[model samples]
Target: MMSDVFLRIENLRKEFGATPVVNGLDLDIKQGEFVSLLGASGCGKTTTLQMIAGFEKPTSGRIWLNGKDITDVPPSKREIGIVFQNYALFPHMTVEENILFGLVLRKVDKAAQRKRLSELLDLVHLVGLEARYPRELSGGQQQRVAIARALAIKPNVLLLDEPFSNLDARLRADMQNEVKRLQIETGITTILVTHDQAEAMALSDRLAIMHKGVALQVDTPQATYDHPASRYVGNFLGNINILQADLRDVGSHVSFSANGKSLQVLNDQRLSPERCCISIRPERVRIQPQPTDCEVLLGATVTSKNYNGNSWDIGTETELGSVNINIPHHGAPTPDRGQSIVVGWNLNDMRLVHVD
Candidate 1:
């Protein structure tokens, strides 16, 4: 599908009063690709979405949609559907009226409009609530109405700006499932802008990690979490334990040593052997009372242990360094504080990460 580039942003840049919000960002989205622009607040994710929606002008760049440049296209002509964070439904309008508003503006034939309205209501599971005003609906129902309104015109691409932020935790999760279902059924090229890591990972086929007005890395959600290109991206996605060590190249392999403990790593010719920092996920580490067969094993004493619902987060002090291990809490006895334990992990779990 690499040949089917449906949306492209070339060197996109936006500046307000000399402060650049988005700078030199280039991204290619395949047809039917679901991509999320992810980052913290003020990281320019929303600004980037605004530019793509043609609501904000880029200071310098080009946006291509379906093989044509749309940088200067008006929002009305772009055929893009947007679902805002606040679910911007008309207060006085009924759900049916809100959904039909777009079709009415496009002057769709009455018969066709009725058919689409019926289908959308069913698509979003709002069959019997069509006559209810926005005030009469729950937050989730209101969100469904917003989505139905956006999709009524059959847009080429869909943009969602933190669409679940206003809902409660359970409702937010339900809405996420609904949006994913809609995207799969409609096959619309979708772009979601969100600051929530879990939401972005759950909904996106590809995630773009943005920081300081630029995208640090764009990859699948799992790949991004497993092999983050930088420390910031790694820590942002999940819990990561970073170790500083001296790197030694051993012919076709590399060894990282710190405080008399060493771990062998696969030789990646792409990376220089002199790198000093490597990272591993806390969950990748295993804790046992006795040493097991592993690429790296260290004896440590538990300094603290906290029991989460599904896992025990144990902090320990070892010869290698201060290490944290997350073990499942499935009826197994957890190690007590000051108790000796062994920590082990595979070499492949440790990834070379940017020190910064």
Candidate 2:
């Protein structure tokens, strides 16, 4: 149950040599919430993570956790566990010793230390390999060791910094599952920093899409994908076809026209620009040889088609505009190149995105 504000960032800012990295960033994370800071390289996601980890000082702003301010807290006293991108494990120490390092520093009793060690080994599925050195372990195994080490002390919150970037495709998926399971079982509020959109959507309860040190949009992965607040966020999240259009008011509704082809949708009221753009996702467009007499979103000729396992990515030049259509191959007959097709979509799926 994600309830109450567990962590809050207030007007955070950071700079280096007069260049701003993070500016006026404010975010609230609920208890047990898994949030990811997502963006491209140089977007300040890593810098934000460092500030939260107490490794970098903010030029201005404060960070609150539980109920107290921790902006000035030392990393050692923050009780935050982090799994670095490279899975930083000691070269010489065995997995057991590495995991026990934190407990040893705290001087926990021997019996308690042994009990926790056994539990962690079991938790990360490394029960039999606790004696092996990091060099002897595979990348996935080393990652598991790093996770075990981070969780050995039962931290209040966990931070993951592109932890799966070094793994292969299959291994990365496996590790993502492992991390999700660990978070669920341990109930540790988690934060992730990643440039991979799929990774962020897969691992986060909600993701904040940041750019140039600021969060442009923060919402659940699906909601944000479906209703991106801006064109940049929409295109960044997935493939979006931006069609130039003129907007005209129609009572409580709005009509968008592209090259004289028009469709009306309930006015979301946030849009006011007389001339704006419309964003349509490929999945939203249905490509059929003949759509019923009701309404066709657009008419187009297929220029190219590629079968991608579960879907056919068809590129088309339409009367409305050029757009890509992703047709799912669930028994639907494939459309050949040069075939004439009509596209249809629900009005509700066409969200009004502000141009940035």
Which residue pairs come into collision in candidate 1? none
lDDT of all predictions? 0.89, 0.87
- Report the C-alpha lDDT of model 1 over 60-108, residue by residue, as the tens digit: 9899999889999999999999999998999999999999999999999
Candidate 2 wrong stretches, greater than 4 Å: 1-3, 250-252, 258-262, 274-276, 331-333
Clash pairs for candidate 2: none
TM-score per model over all chains? 0.95, 0.94
Flag regions of model 1 displaced more than 4 Å: 249-253, 258-262, 267-269, 273-276
lDDT of 2 by residue, 81-190 (tens): 99999988999999999999899999999999999999998999998998899999999999999998889888988999999999999999999999999999999999
Work out how many backbone clashes candidate 2 has.
0
Clashes of each: 0, 0
